[model samples]
Target: MTWKTKVNSALEGITGYTIVRPRPQAPPPKDTPRPPADPKIDRLLRAPVFVLSPVRSGSTLLRVMLNSHSRIHAPHELHIRRIAVSLTTEPVRQAMDALGHSPSDIEHVLWDRMLHRELVASGKDIIVDKTPSNVFAHRRISTCWPDARFIFLMRHPASIAGSWHEADPQERPMEEAVRHTLQYMRYLQEARRRYDGLDLRYEALVDDPEGEMRRVCTYLGIGYEPGMIEYGRHDHGEFVKGIGDWRDKIRSGRVQRGRPLPAPEDVPEDLREVATAWGYLQES
Candidate 1:
């Protein structure tokens, strides 16, 4: 017998137990075709709002303003997409299949129930989820909540890169910031092209908070409230790191103007196309 085998046998005899290695598990399938939502079995929340934007685009600011309204509850980044359901046993899988529920369908139900619970707890008529990464899963979100509404938030691409780097200079260098932030920009642009939603710019938001907020209220089919412009007066949960912007600027209570846009010539070549498409740059 092999030396390793003899050693293992000896250890088993001395210890009175054999080593048990876990079986390898296959990775779950991705992009499983989700059946269309059926009102009879689908969403618990009606017409939920999703704000799609790149990181450092002032979504936290918008969320706070929306939260200030009496009838609206704009919670911090609830990355519900990351919350997954696993079928741990054959019987569990068989039971779900018997109910005509695909793996994705079960996940959809879980996502909806969680959001609806949050909404009910807050006692708000509308719930807005402003997770920036939601742009990457925009199609899946649409499929999950067929009656969902979208709000596309835009910013100058160079400014977004600069802000992302500034948020943590040591952890997020300029080169990496540009590359990482660009991914979100591309996905957000794709969603904007495909979905019909209200578009708001960060620059415009800070420049005229009242006007922009009024427009948002109108779109959501609610009357504009003065409290929305004074977002600092209300409690908008915590400004924690992972959940949303945790910077002092967000904690300041009132709307502050955004940084000046980078010069057209200073815009990076990589971001020029998206900038031009977003109206921050003119095509040469």
Candidate 2:
């Protein structure tokens, strides 16, 4: 007999069962349409804002600036999309179904409640979550809060990759940085294409903080406050790693000028398309 046959026969004789490996579970379906918000099921938190951006795109700076506003509370990156629920038992699943709740619906309720709690605790009229990874779940976010607003934060693709590599050069080499950060750029671009939102660039924001803040305030239907430009005076929580930008530049507590954009010729071939699309490079 072959080695496999012998091993299986021996295992069956010893344990009364043959070796069986479990099959890999498939990923959940994508873009499943969530029902529009129902008054009875969803409440609390109105016209919440989301800053969709890639990693190392200066979202933290924007967050703190907006947070300094009297009426806006831009909190640290709250990765609510990563939070999930599981129907562990049949009874629990049945109960949810009886209540006309799908798994997604329950999770949406939890996400809403969490943000509402934050907004209430801060005593602010508006809440903004600037989690970069949220670009992947733009659809779900739009569905969860029909009145949600978005700010599409754009940075030069070459700058994003260079900064990402510098953030952890040993772990993120230049080559890998382009590949990894490009995913966010693509998703951010797709969200921009599919959604209606204000587009702001990292370069312009730093060069003209007051001008951009005024524009943003206008979009949100609020008067621009001068304090937003002086965000260094506010206590915007701990500038720790992971949740958001935790580098010295962010810790500087000022709107520092962004790095000069790479020349068109210096832009990496891999990033050329996106850089041009984002208006960082002129189309030939």
Candidate 3:
């Protein structure tokens, strides 16, 4: 069986799995309200969150909020964590050993060596690797660290398209947006397929900032502090400046230009389904 299948098989043994592909149906109307917590769900107190979602999809916004919490110190999108985990995990280590490397060499070449080098290079801890592509490897990641928490950030496709167009006018905006949304969608689906009882929270953080942040922290097993709601007001330049010169970009916009593209109302009808699946009110 393929590694993915094996992982899926292993996950089947666990109960209370929640795979959210295509985003959970727009939580009943605002008043209907979904249950905030389930007894079966394991509380992940202060567990590091691997914020996985598409780029330009409010990821930075979510990261900044978590960073604002006194207990959290999230850096910008540092992809090296997944790489570190992949190279150091026991199964991966065994594969390397089978390929003929001394234990000392493997230890030096794998975990301690590269991770320490990168951590020092960046100078951060309580690290959060916020990469959209990380979702692509969620199965491996969940298998590697079963208790790890995930928060998937989603944005309306039209807004995602607009943001992409604003960032670089070269690409076909609509196409890029659809492609981006689908990539994360498939990852969410696959993660559910592979990890039976994975603890993941998916939110359209841009839509309901306060409510989502509360649920996100709850899933992370952290208390809901008011500070998390105003992270955008803080100066996150220390870690924010590193990703795509985003600090400069955020400074350029006249309006409140947070990471997530605003909900799109101008999206063409043909493409409205994409936004709907992405968890946004349909554009008429």
- Which one wins on TM-score? 1
Clashing pairs in 1: none
> Whole-model Cα lDDT per candidate?
0.91, 0.91, 0.54
Candidate 3 lDDT trough over 10 residues, lowest sum? 27-36
- Alpha-carbon shift of residue 39 in model 1 (angstroms): 1.6
For model 1 the TM-score comes to: 0.90
Expressed as tens digits, the lDDT of each residue in 103-187 for candidate 1 is 8888899898999999999999899999999999999999888778999999999999999998889999998999999999999
**lDDT comparing candidate 2 with the true structure:** 0.91
What TM-score would each prediction reach against the true structure? Answer: 0.90, 0.88, 0.57
Better of 2 and 3 by TM-score: 2
Whole-model lDDT for model 1 versus the true structure? 0.91
Q: What are the per-model numbers of colliding residue pairs? A: 0, 0, 0
TM-score of 2: 0.88
**Model 1 lDDT, residue 251, Cα:** 95
Cα lDDT tens digits, model 3, 16-84, are 764333544342211211111331332222234576666666676666777677656666665643442
In the range 195-253, model 2's lDDT, one tens digit per residue, is 89999999999999999999999999999999999999998999989899888888888
Q: Which pairs of residues clash in candidate 2, taking residues 3 or more apart in a chain or in different chains?
A: none
Pairwise lDDT winner, candidates 2 and 3: 2
